[model samples]
Target: MNPRTMHSIFLKKKRTMVAIAMLSVGSISAQTFSDFSYKGNDKIYTNNPLKENEFYSPILQGCYPDPSITRKGDDYYLVNSSFSMFPGVPIFTSKDLVNWKQVGHVLDRPSQLKVEKGGVSQGIYAPDIKYNKYNDTFYMITTQIAGGIGNMVVKTKDPAKGWSEVQKLNFDGIDPAIFFDDNGKAYIVHNDAPPKGTEQYNGHRVIKIWDYDLEKDQVVAGSDKIIVNGGVDLSQKPIWIEGPHIYKKAGKYFLMCAEGGTGGNHSEVIFMSDSAKGPFVPATNNPILTQRYFPKDRRDKVDWAGHADLVETPDGKYYGVFLAIRPNEKGRVNHGRETFILPVDWSGKYPVFENGLVPMKPKLKLPEGVKNKTGKDGFFPNGNFTYIDKLTDKNLDFRWIAMRGPRENFITSAKNGVKVNPMETNIKALAPVSALFHRLQHEDFETSVSLDYKPKSEKELAGITCYQSERFNYVFGITKKDKDFYIVLERTEKGESKLIASEKITLSKAIKLQVIGERDEHQFNYSLDGKNFKNLGGPVSGDILSTDVAGGFTGSLIGLYSTSSNDIKP
Candidate 1:
């Protein structure tokens, strides 16, 4: 059979596998998930809904940034950066490229991820997952910013199963991606600072390529070379040229990278060369994908778009997955950088992201015959949807995540929900806390939970936290204030904690605590009975939970938090 014809058949088979996997995913969840991690029976209803023949542009949302895609024949896998959050490097699978199901984290085991002592933003960064057909193995290469483990790679025949131990690479850079040539030679592409004293300006980075030894899983000695410097044009003084990936197509080598930092000026630029390690030349029409040129107030605006990876389908079509932010009405990024996809017009000499230059529409038309299964079956949810997790499933949902340690470390299934054993470290500490977090997915939303707890002492507290990081967050929970139990709301900004409000409460029964996020503000409420809610704090500014104010690469996380080192005095 012809290669193209075989790929078509393989796609059909893979599509069928996806359907079966979606329908039967919950049945096999126990084999993958740890049950009842912090009891987040959440219901999120966003305002963006899909229209006919359309799906959401952000195939994955809420801090899922720096998306890299890889293809093995008809099957596709996508991965993202996971900084400090334990079980780093979230990996997902898709057949149609629209619907995605998280197979699991790439660094799922404690031995694979050692971020326990690193800051909240110092774990995995910009992981690139690529399938090497030469060995029939998948390689996930990334930079671990913690524990002195710099650039690393892990391999596995199947992604759904657990991955191998980390193979630390001998390099000092960020965002390392491995590319395998057709002749079985592999190369490593990454962004690094220019050779010492060669720095012409700040943020002056270069893209370098090295011959990768397949047998040793190391970059070949003395084979590294600089392919691109100072981005597309030297006169422009381009900043932060990073997140590089190489592709070999039609006997030509393409090196795509994100330029101008990760904020508003961010963009994807392309360069081509005849050889893998090359004197590559920038494309005449560069910045193949960007949202910075559009007006800031454009309707349904998407901004800070860059850090992309591309993949070609079996039918000769191309798509680019990148990170972009959807700022709230107050012009703050509470949603952080999300994963968005756009079709590529690669028919020309250069691949341009179609509809990528303009203000992005929330929806994309589905491929010819692929049905949209988002929010249904086992695929990841997007657009306008209401997701309800009842805290009763035998297996934990893949959506639940923790920081610095595995969710299993502090959570246990008991009494129809998760029992969080309060850790010595508090939410304000750099170390791991006893909390399970779900991303703050929507700008305007309400997240509520029932907590049956009576503080035995002032040090023990259990409640909900709207956290941007350890330095900036809000802690609302039950704590004993001098022999009296009270529900207190505390705000921590830049490592300083201030009491926002406190209510003396009788600990007679289970109480429902809720946090309502309304784009610019958040409201804390409590209900003695499940339905009757009384506001604890009228409204608090959401500035602390925004990336713009907090100054981090991550978005706000809504955590079911419990801690034994409580320091908030109310």
Candidate 2:
């Protein structure tokens, strides 16, 4: 489909038909589904109330992307790259591939992550998590950019208990993966820096393989070799040939990597070689899976479907989970890169989606025992009303992320509540400031936080924020202009903060601040008595703070923030 058709399908001017249903199962209710559907990508979402043999689309929603999955016995474990978000590399588990729940994060401790001054989308890159049957250990390999410590690996036998400290690996390029041969030999494959610089072409990259030294925990000397250089078809000059995964299937080594960058032109290519490290040959039909080319009758525009990993169920069926984005009318995506699953049809020369995959499918069947589930404790729909206390132990939940680590000192807890000392820097600064937030998991959700902070100056503000980046965010907090203190709602888009709305009120020692997000707009509210809330004139366009609008790898983070001037003392 063309860009125009994609827009028409989602544009407000076009009266797109929306079908809704209610499905309730037990005490849990289906709270979320795809908002709108196109002609080909029609999705009729229901809060499926019954326990059935079915699964929902976008199985793991929000900005979860670059998925790496492995199956052990009847259980499946998956992990995704958490860029700049603290407690990085969220790991998930599922009996059925369709319904997944977060088990824990690989980098849950403060010492594992160090993205203080890192760029918004600069911390962790694509990570490959695998289970070594020989040693019975789970391993996760990843890269940290923007003053990061480079490539590293962490292992754990029980992911729920947490992972071990980092075993730093030396690699020049990023997007690393580990493959263990059936012979019990371990190998590492990664997207390597170009022997020839990038000016050569757009997707100029190399996939290198190395023999890993398990005892020493490093790559063996002189064992490094380039397997797939410059992607499948070098004549086309592929770019961003990254996210490589090697698998031994049918007695041959299968190598898969995402090419054509990570944007609209994104795609997946496959190569085959006899040896784990060898001169692999590309499949005749190079791009085994891609949404770029479409048949005339197809109507859905699920662009950027790349960065995939393969998994086999107990039944021996294969499936590929990749990343894709659903764009709005303006062709700007706010959802970030979401995970999409497809049946990997292996009947052909190489495995691929038989007829391509849609962004959202109405119904899918899973094994009978596999039931659709959400949340760690229960299914909490994305856009539901849930209040989180400032001092609850849930503050350390996997969903609660920080700008960086070593947070115990700055973010402290008291018997009454959590105390956030203002960092000597604003949110706009590149350096990590004192900030705590939760991912904007829903397109429409209500969030409110209680703040007892009394800002003595403009630099000592503490309240809630709808953050997109350092430059783009909507801050709803209390700041002092002079002797008079006021509750303020400021819109900071494109790095400039302008007072959009304000209300002068007397503080009762504590106040309730709220932000209600409705698709493209957000409303700010405040309550002095905790009973009634006054809308502080919001309806601010939230599209400007989206991934497409702001151009980043992370989605909006809405949570508590406190900032002071760089020179201010705590």
* Best-matching candidate per lDDT: 1
Write down the lDDT of every candidate, Cα atoms only: 0.83, 0.71
Which ten contiguous residues of candidate 1 have the minimum total lDDT?
A: 28-37
Candidate 2 global TM-score: 0.84
Model 1 per-residue lDDT tens digits across residues 1-570:
432344345445644654554455332211111121222111222344555687878888789989999988778999999899976888899999988999878887767788988877788999999999888999999999988899999998888776778899988889999999999999999999999999999999999999999999999889999999889997889999999999888999999999989999999999999999888999999888888887777877789999999999999999999999988778989878999999999887788999888788887899888899987888988765556665656356777889998776666555466656677799987787878898877777777777877777787788889989999999988888887988899999998888989989887777788887776888999887778998986899999999989997998898888877888777
Give per-residue lDDT, candidate 1, residue 471: 93
Error of 2 at 531 (Å): 4.4
Residue-wise lDDT of candidate 2 within 126-197, one digit each (tens)?
A: 989898888888889999874557999888777666677777887679999999888989999999877854
Candidate 2: lDDT over CA atoms?
0.71
lDDT of the structure predicted as candidate 1: 0.83
- Give model 1 RMSD, 1 decimal: 8.4
Write down the TM-score of every candidate.
Answer: 0.91, 0.84
